[model samples]
Target: MNKLNVLFLTLSSMENINERGIYTDLVRELASRGIYIHVVFPRERRLGLPTELEIIDNIKLLKVKTGNITETRFIEKGISTLTIENQYLKAVKKYFGNINFDLIIYSTPPITFERVIQYLKKKHQSKTYLILKDIFPQNAVDIDILKNNSFIWKYFRNKEKHLYEVSDMIGCMTKGNVQYILNHNPYIDRNKVEVFPNSIEPIDRNNISIINNEIKEKFQIPAHLTLFIYGGNLGKPQGIDFLIRVAENFYKIENSYLLIVGSGTEYETIKNYIDSRHPKNVNLIKSLPKKEYDQLLRSADVGLIFLDKRFTIPNFPSRLTSYFEYSLPVLAATDKHTDLKNILIESNSGFWCESGDLDSFIHLAKSLADNNVLRKQMGLKGRDYLEDNYDIRKTANIIMKHL
Candidate 1:
C-alpha cells in the first residue's frame, strides 16, 4: 500500500525530539507507521530554529518566523492580535505556499489559521482535519475572559464557525467537546465529528527505573515522603489558585509533599505563595526536559491533574499520558463532567475530586499516602490500562484506519 502524505500545521512555538505535543506525537506516530509527514510551525521569538530545514526520523520539520512582539501585559492584547495575524499570513505565504498534501491536519488555539486552511483546501483539494484541542471563544466566555455578547465574542465566533465549515472532519479530544461543537452548530454533520483521545508511546519500566533514584535525589525529594507531582502548565485553566490553597492547607504534613514542575502564567503567583508561606512540603520547579520529567514522574508516588471548574467542555489533559506510562496512579481535580474522571474511575487507576474542594483533595491525598498497598494496586491498574489502550502503535493503527 502507498503511504499517505500528511501535512500538519500548528501554531506551537517549538518542537523538541522527545517532548510531547499533540502535533509532534501525531507526526512521529504517523511516520513510524510508514506515512510521510511534513510539519510547519510558527517560529516565534522564543523558539530558536535552524534556518535550513531538519529531518527527525522520517518526518520533516519546517519553522517559519512569526511576529516578534511579546504580549505579557493587558495593554498588549490588541497589539498581539495584529502582530499574530500578520505573522501567520507571512508564515503561510513563505513556507506553506509550495507544499501540496494528501491530508492537512491543523491544531488550533489561535483560530487565525482558518483562512490558511480555506486556501489549502481549495488549492490542493485535500482533506482537512481540524483537531480541536481547545475551545477558544467559548472558553474565554466561560471564564469571563470575554463577554458573550461583546464585539470580540461575535467576531471570533464567526471565525470559529468558518474554521469548522472549512474542515472535512473535526477531531475532538473528548466526547463532551464533540457534543459541544454539535450543539453550537446544529447544521454540522454528526458523522464528520469524532472523538480521538490523546495517546502516548509505551515506556520500558526497566529503562525508567534506572534513573528513578537519581531523579528523586536531584529534586531533593525525601525517600520517606509521598510525592504528589503536578507536571504541566500552571495557568488559569488549571485553577492554580486552588492548588496554592491546597498547598497552604497541607504545608505542615511531614509525610507528604506537593512537587509542582512546570511554568505558565500562574508560575509567579504560586512561587510567591510558596516563598511567603515557606512551606517545607511544597516545592516548585521550572519545566524540565521531557526525559527528565518522565523520569521524575516514574519515580514519583502520584501524578496530579487539575482543571478549572469554569471549563464547560471536557478537558482531557495530555499530561495524563505520562502518569499512565509510568503506572503512577492519578489524582485528578476538575469539574464534575470531565472525561478524565470517567477514565480514571473506569480503569480503577486513580481517584477524582471536584475542583476547588480542598478538604476532599487533602483527604484523598492523605488516603493515598497512608495506604501504600492501595496506591500500588491502583498504579498497576493504570499500567495495565495504558498497555491495553494508549500504546502508540495501536493508536496509530486506529488513526490510519480512519485515513
Candidate 2:
C-alpha cells in the first residue's frame, strides 16, 4: 500500500489549506487521511507577489505569478485566462517535475487547462479529474458579457470542449450541471460525469453563542431585528440590480434588517443606491475578513441568494454552505434553471422565488422575520442538510473511490 499523492490546480488564491473555502476544505480532508496534497494556485498581478512555493499545513503550495484575473478590466482578465495554461505548465515542470502524482484534480472558470492536463496525464499516467464549477463562455454569454458564437466565444468553447475531452472524470456541482454538460457536448460520455457538489468541512457553530452579540455590536447589526444577510460576490451573476430592488422594497418588511456584504463590479451600483436612498432597514459593507464574516454569519437570521434570471446553466453559489454552517436558514431568489429551489424545498430549510419577483421576496422575507420558531426550525433543517449532503468527507470519499 502506498500513500496517495494528488496535484490540485485551481484559479482560487488560497494562501493556506486551513482557510475556509470549498477547495481548501476538500484538500484538508485529503491531507487528514495521510495523502500528500500539492496545490498550485495563482498569484495575480495586482497582488505584486512573485511566483513561489511554500509548505503550508502539510500541503505543498506553488504560487505561480500571473496576470490579473479577478476584479480587473475585461481585456486583462481575458489575456490572463488565455496565458495561464502555459504559465501553470512551466511552473509545475520547474517545481514538481520529478514527483509522480496518483491523481491530478483541476477546477474550471478558465477552461484552458487541456494542454496541462494532457501533458500530465501522458507523463504521469495519472487519472485526471475535472471539478466543473463554472460553465465557461456560455455563462459569460448568459450574462451578456460575451456574445454567443463570436470568435472569442468559439475559441473558448473549443477550449472547454477539449478540456472535457481530456479529463478521465468530470465532477459536477449538481445533477443539473451533469445533465447540462452531457446535453451540450454529446461527444462526452455520461458515465464519467457525477455529482460532486460545492462542499465544505462544516464548523459546529450551532452551539457557539459567545461572540454573536459582540460581532453584532461590532458591525452595528441590530439585535432586535431578524437579520437577513447577502454575502459573497456581488457581481452581475448575482443579479445586483434585483438585489437593489430588494433593498429598496425592504421597507415593507417590518422588524427585519438586510445586510449586504461583499465586493464586486456591481458593488458601486448597490453602494450608490444604499448611500443615496439611505434605507433605514438596510446596511451595506464593502467586505469582511473570513474569520469576521463567519462570526457575522452567526448573528444573521437568514442567508440570501440571488442569481440572474438569464442564466441557462445551474449556478450554485458556495455561500450557501456558510449559512448552513452557522445554522442560518436560506432565502433564495434565483433563475428557474437552477435546482436550488428544489434543494431548499426538499430539505425543508428555506424559501425560494424567481429573481425578478420583488413581491414574493418581500412576503417570504416578512414571514421569516415575523416568526422566530419557523426560523429556528428551518435553520436546524439546513444544518442537517449540510451534514448529510455537502460535507467535505463525502467529497473526499468520492474522489478517493474514483482514484
Candidate 3:
C-alpha cells in the first residue's frame, strides 16, 4: 500500500498537544502507526512569540500564531476566530509549501476554515474529512447564545452550512448526531455523513488501581463516603448553575461526596456557591497535570457527567474516557438528545438521567453510593465496553477506509 500523508487543521493550541484531549490522543495514536502526519495548531499567545515549528512524538507540528483567543472575552474571541483563516493560510504557504498531502482532516469550532479547507482540497486534490464535533448555529440557538434572524446568527448559520457542503465526508460523533445532521440540513447529501463516535487510545488497566490511601488522605477525602468525581472544563455549556444545584442537593447526603476538578468561565460561580454553602461533602480542585489528574481519577469511586438541559445539540464530553480508563462507573446527567443513555444501559456500564431532574440524579447517586459491589461490577463493564468500542485504532481504521 502507498504511504498516506495527512494534513490536519485543528485550533487546539500547541500548549495542549501532550494533554489528554480529543485530538491529542488520536493524533498520537495515528502518528505511532507510522503514517505521515503534519499537524497545524494555534501558537498559544505569549507576548513576543512568533509562529514556530517543532516535532513531537514523531509528528510534525506547526504552531501558527494568531490573535489572542481561548481565554478572552466574547468580542475578542469572535474577532480572533473570524480572522484565523488568513493566519492559517499564510503559515501553510510559508511552512508546508507545495507538499501535497493525500488527505485533509479538520474539526469544527470556529467554522471559519471553509476557505482553507477549500484551498487544500483543490490544491492537493485531497479527500477532506470533517470531524463535526458539534452542530454550530443551532447549538448556539439551543442555549440562547445566538438569537435567530439576527446578523450574528445569520453569519454563523451560513458558515455552518458552507462547511458541511465543502467536506467530502462528515464524521458525526454518534448515530443521533448523524441523524440530527441529516434531518436538520436537507441540503447535505445523506451519503456524505456517517457515525464517527469519539475514541481514545486504549491503555492497559491491569496494574492501574485506585491510588493508595495517601492521595485520599492528602486531599482530606473521607474514607467512609463514596467519592464521585467530575473533572473537565466548567462553563456555561456544562450547565454550571445546574451543577451548583446538583452539588447543593448532595450537601446533606453524608454517604455521597462530590469532587469537582478543573476550571473555566464559571469557575468563580461554582467556587462562590461552594463558599456560600460550605458543603462539607464536596471538594473543589483546580486543574492539575494529566498524570496527576489520572491518579486522582483512579482514587474516585464514580464519574459524574453533566450537560445543560437546554442543549438541543447532542453534546458528548470526551471526559467519559477518563472515567472508563479508571474502571469507574459513570452517572451521567445530560440533556435528552444524546443517545448516551441507551449506550450506557446496553453496555450495562452505567446509568443516565435527564439533566434538569434533581430527583433522578439524586436517586441514582444514592443507589451507587449505597452499593459498593454494584459500583465495582458496573465499573468493570464500563472498562470492557471502552476497550471494545472506543479504542482509537478502531476509529482510525474506519476513517482510513474513506481515504
Candidate 4:
C-alpha cells in the first residue's frame, strides 16, 4: 500500500517537527506510523522571511508569508487575518498542488479559512478535519473586544459556520466545548463533533536532570519560596485585570511567589502594575525562550491558569499540558462555564476557583504552598492523567481513523 499523505493547516508557527509541543508531537507520531505529513503555516511579516518549504523525516513544512497575525495593532491584526486565506491558498497551489492529499486537517483562530478548506476538499477529494481550538468571534465578544451580533460579528459568524460546514469532522478541546458548539450551532451534526482535547508528548521528568539552583539563581527566582507560575499568553482573554489583582494580593500566601511569563497585548498592564506597586512576592517576566521556559517549568512548584469570567464559550488553555509534563500541580481560576474545574477534580491533579474570587485563589495557593505532601500527590496524579488522557498517540489515532 502507498504511504498515506496528509495536509495540515495551522496558524501556529513551527520551524521544526521535533519541537516539544502539541502540534509537533502529534505530527511526529503520525509520521512514525508511515504517514507523510505536509504542514502549511505562517511566516509573519515581522520575521522578514519569504515563503519557504523544507522536508524533515518524511514530513513537509511549507511556511507561507503572511501579514502580522500575532501581537500587533488591531487594524493590522484584523487585516492580516482577513487576507491569510488567499496567501495560504496561493502558496499551497504553487507548492503542494500536484500532491493528492488523502486527508486535510486545519485548526481555528481565524475562521476565514473556509475558502482554503473548501477548495482543498474539492481539489484533492480529501477528508477534512477541523480542530476547534478557539471559538473566535464569540470569545472576542465575551472579552468586549467585539460587540455581540454587530456587522463584524455577523460576518465572522457566517464564515465560522461555513468553515464548520466544509469540515468532515470537528474535534473540540473538551466536553464543555463540544456541548457549547452543539447548543449554539444546532445545524452541526452531533456525531461529527467529539472531545479531542489539547494533547502533548508526555515527558517523564524523573529522567531529566534539572539544575534547580542554577535555574533559580539565573532567573532571580526566590530559592525558598513556593514558586507559582502563569505561563503562556498575557492577553485579554486571560483576564489580565484579575491576574494583576491576584499578584497584588499574592503576599497573603505565606512563603509563596508568583511568576508571570509570556507576552501579549496586555503585557504592559501587568508590567505597569509591577513597576508601580513593586510587589515583593510577585515577579513579572515579559517572555522567555522555549528552552528557558521549560527549565523554569521544571523548577516551579505550581502552575496557574486564568480565563476571563465573561466568556460564555468554554476556553481551554493548552498550558495545562506544559504544567502536567513536569509533574507540577495546576491551579486554575476560570469562568464557571469551562470544564477545567471538573477535570481538576476528576484527575485529582489540582485546585480551581471562579476567576474573580480572590479569597478562594489565595486560600488554595496558601494550602498548596504550605503542604508539600499534598502538592506532590496532586502533581503525580496530574502527570498520570496527562499520560493516560492527553497523550499525542491518542490524538494521532483520532486523525488516523479518518484516513
Off by over 4 Å in 2: 205-211
Clash list (residue pairs), candidate 1? none
For candidate 4, the C-alpha RMSD (Å) to the true structure equals 1.1
Clashing pairs in 4: none
Model 4 spans > 4 angstroms off: 209-211
Ranking by TM-score: 4, 2, 3, 1
Residues 1-403 of candidate 3 have per-residue lDDT tens digits of 5677888888876455676666887787777777778898887564457888887756788888888776566677788888899899889889888688888889878788999999888899989999988688788788777798789999998988888888999998888899889998998999999887788875688668636766778788887778999999887788887788888888655577899998777888899889888876887988888878888788899999988889887888888877988899999999998888878898888889998888988888888988899999999999998888888888888777876
Candidate 1's C-alpha runs over 4 A off are 18-21, 47-52, 68-89, 209-211, 252-254
TM-score for all predictions? 0.92, 0.98, 0.95, 0.98
Q: What lDDT tens digits, residue by residue, belong to model 1 across residues 73-175?
A: 4235435544565555555567556767788888876676788778777888988888788877887777677899799788888888888899888888878
lDDT of 1: 0.77
Ranking by lDDT: 4, 2, 3, 1
Number of backbone collisions per candidate, in order? 0, 0, 0, 0
Residue range 1-403, candidate 4, lDDT tens digits: 4879999999998886777888988888988999999999999999999999999878999999999989887789999999999999999999998899999989998788899999988998999999999998999999888998899999998999999999999999999999999999999999999988899988766654464668888878779999999999998899998999999899899998899999999899889989999987888887887888998988899999999999999889999999988889999999999998899999999999999999999999998999999998999999989989999988888998889
User: How accurate locally, in lDDT, is each candidate?
Assistant: 0.77, 0.90, 0.84, 0.91
Q: Give model 2 RMSD, 1 decimal.
A: 1.2
Query: Which TM-score value belongs to model 2?
Result: 0.98
True-structure RMSD, every candidate = 2.4, 1.2, 1.7, 1.1
Error of 2 at 21 (Å): 1.2
